[model samples]
Target: MFSGLSAFPLTPMNESGIDEAAFVRLIERLADASVDSIGALGSTGSYAYLSRAERARVVKLAVEHAGNVPVIAGIGALRTSDVQALSDDAQKAGASAVLLAPMSYQQLSADEVFGLYETVTRSLSVPLCVYDNPGTTHFEFSSELYGRIAQLPNVRSIKIPGVPANPAAAKAHIESLRALIPSHVTLGVSGDASAAMGLNSGCEAWYSVIGGLFPKTALAITRAAQAGDMKAATRLSERLQPLWALFDQHGGSLRVVAAAAELQGVVEHPCLPLPLKALDGTGRQQLAVLLDELELA
Candidate 1:
């Protein structure tokens, strides 16, 4: 049922801290744009930086603003108990599902991975979405492991990033998920720019960081592609090309999305933690150039 434009929102923060008003306004904008669902506290939300209480509050605000819409809360954590805590808070806040990435501590064997999943699954009271964000967590789950993990009662879906060593292997992994995994579990596609291509290749939804800043264009692209209208899809994708371009020329998803937030006037403070920097003057100017080229500045 998680099939369509999935928006990963940017967690709004100001001098005082998590800006609830800005956060709600951002969600409202996405809602007006007809985004299918929302994934909160993922990389786009700067999950690693937020405290436990702060993260819970953000999830609550997302659910409140989203109303009946499916708000998928992110539960990626270094510690297993922390994942459960996030999941619990998400459920309390009215989230529809919890997206869990693997432990970010160290490299884990397939055997150890399954054990970790089993532990979380046992305590999970809400639906679980496996987040295969290899870029950050360095843990790309194998298809052989997925077939087994998908059998968990709480396991509901997965969001796989497209950055695989062997690109075809990632596609092969997705194909295996379709074939071996149960039919009930949904599979969403990620990797910002090529989301449309993944949808055509059998992914159910397109999870996008660009969606937070430009939901209208993001959903437009997804909807157009879903309807098999390549021309319309191309048009919408072109509108979002600027955001992806910023991502390519900048740091990672947070900096890119934060830059879009600044450019779009969504947040007041887009600062990240130490070692993680926001888009600077030259970077901002470069992004502005891209936006100008797209006529969206």
Candidate 2:
């Protein structure tokens, strides 16, 4: 399993469709930065908006451009069979791992959740990363649910979100889970603002959104912390304060990446599907400030 800051880049899109050249350029640029791994077609990558064919194309591009770095394919789907099929495609595309988020739908029993992972894992040749982003799912994994998942054979890691406000509580939850689960089941963290929280809490790894635009900054934070230099990590993360705020102010990571991808000229138009607003004029201004501060331009 890979560790450190893993970035999820937004897919480049325009009026016609995905911009192949621009997408390649973005990946090449990211590879120059210190990313431990790259995750594609994730929430930050706007995976839900793309068609099945488009998703495969995006995953293929990411894996090819990633070089020696590990690739985590986000194969989240609405149906169990669809998810399993996507997982199979990821393995075929050379992804080292795949992320599975339980999609929103009717109330799910524990058996269904188990079956979802079972079906997807049984169909795949590679490890399956269990993604639990409750904000979108409208359902959180209880410690009991995670305990059940923790025992599964093909399960690789659990991508968990930070607890509200209290780092101690978050640490306690993760520690409790880790003690119950085997050491092979890694605990991956989301939300870069809480990254320090995750690291301090003994999280082995993290998945990043800001890394899509500022990979160096994300890597710096993770590296500095891993080296036990808290001060350097704090200052480096503080420099990325604007991007974090942009993620929150814009409703989520998808909007933040879409907006930044446009400002950086990495993608043409940077338009998103319905329900997610592309960068408005003011959002564009915020993006410019974000890039200018990072010296990305």
Candidate 3:
């Protein structure tokens, strides 16, 4: 069921806590854009930074307001019990599925990774998507491990980081993933920059960052790629190049999204949680030029 474009919302924050009003508005905007799914507390949503109670609140709000779209709650945590508890909270909050990553304090083995999912699967009735973001988790999953996890009960999707930014390598990588996984499970690509290539190469979905803030544009590109109109998708991606450049230069998309959302007047604060500051003034100014070039300002 996790197919097409999935928008990973940046949890809109303010000093008082999650800006519920702003959060609601962002969700409604995504729904209006007709994104395929809404990931309420994905990485872009800063799942790691929020308290358990705060995460539950976000899931509840997302499911309540997501309309017909599926709300997939991010249930990843450092400990197994915490992940299971969060999974329960997500189910109780009426999320359609839980996105799980093998987040760990120390390096994890493939067996440990499998064990984590095995335990979570036993506890959760909702469908689970194995989130393979090695960049953040410091855990990696080979195609062999993916098949093993896919065999587990209720494990329905795998959201993996996109291939190397190079187009040919990305295409080959996606084809290999398609060849590895069973037809029952969907393979989604997470890196927003390579989403068009992945979609065109038969990956079922785009777990997107920009889509969270600019779902209309994201959906447009997705539709183009899915319709076999690479030219159209390329045009859209070109327009988005400057934004993606900042993501490459700044280490990741969180700070960039924070700035873009505020630049577009979508959120009250461009800030992230402590230790992860918003883009500095110079960075914001640079982003503003790019956003303006894209007509987002």
Please name the candidate that would achieve the greatest TM-score relative to the true structure.
Answer: 3
Q: TM-score-based ranking, best first? A: 3, 2, 1
**What lDDT, from 0 to 1, does candidate 2 have?**
0.77
Model 3, 1-297: lDDT tens digits are 488889988888755688888889889988888899999899889899899999999999999888998999999999999999999999999999999999998999999999999999987789999999987898889998998899888988999887666678877887787677778899898888878777777788889988888888899988898888977887887778878888988988988888888877888664577677667688999988888778641
lDDT of 2 by residue, 1-297 (tens): 447878878777764678778777777767777588888877877787788888888889988998877889999878987887788788888889899888857977777887787777766678777888887876678777777787776787888886444657877877888877778888888887787667667777778887776787678778887887767776777777787788788777777677777777677664576566676788878787767767742
Which regions in candidate 2 have their CA more than 4 angstroms from the true location?
Answer: none
Reference-based lDDT, residue 105, model 1: 70
Question: What overall lDDT goes with each candidate model?
Answer: 0.77, 0.77, 0.87
Predicted candidate 1 versus true structure: per-residue lDDT over 266-287, tens digit per residue: 7775545445656878887887
**Clash-forming residue pairs, model 2:** none
Q: Could you tell me every candidate's TM-score relative to the true structure? A: 0.90, 0.92, 0.96
Query: What TM-score number comes out for model 3?
Result: 0.96
Q: Which model, 1 or 2, shows the larger TM-score?
A: 2
lDDT of 3 at 198: 77
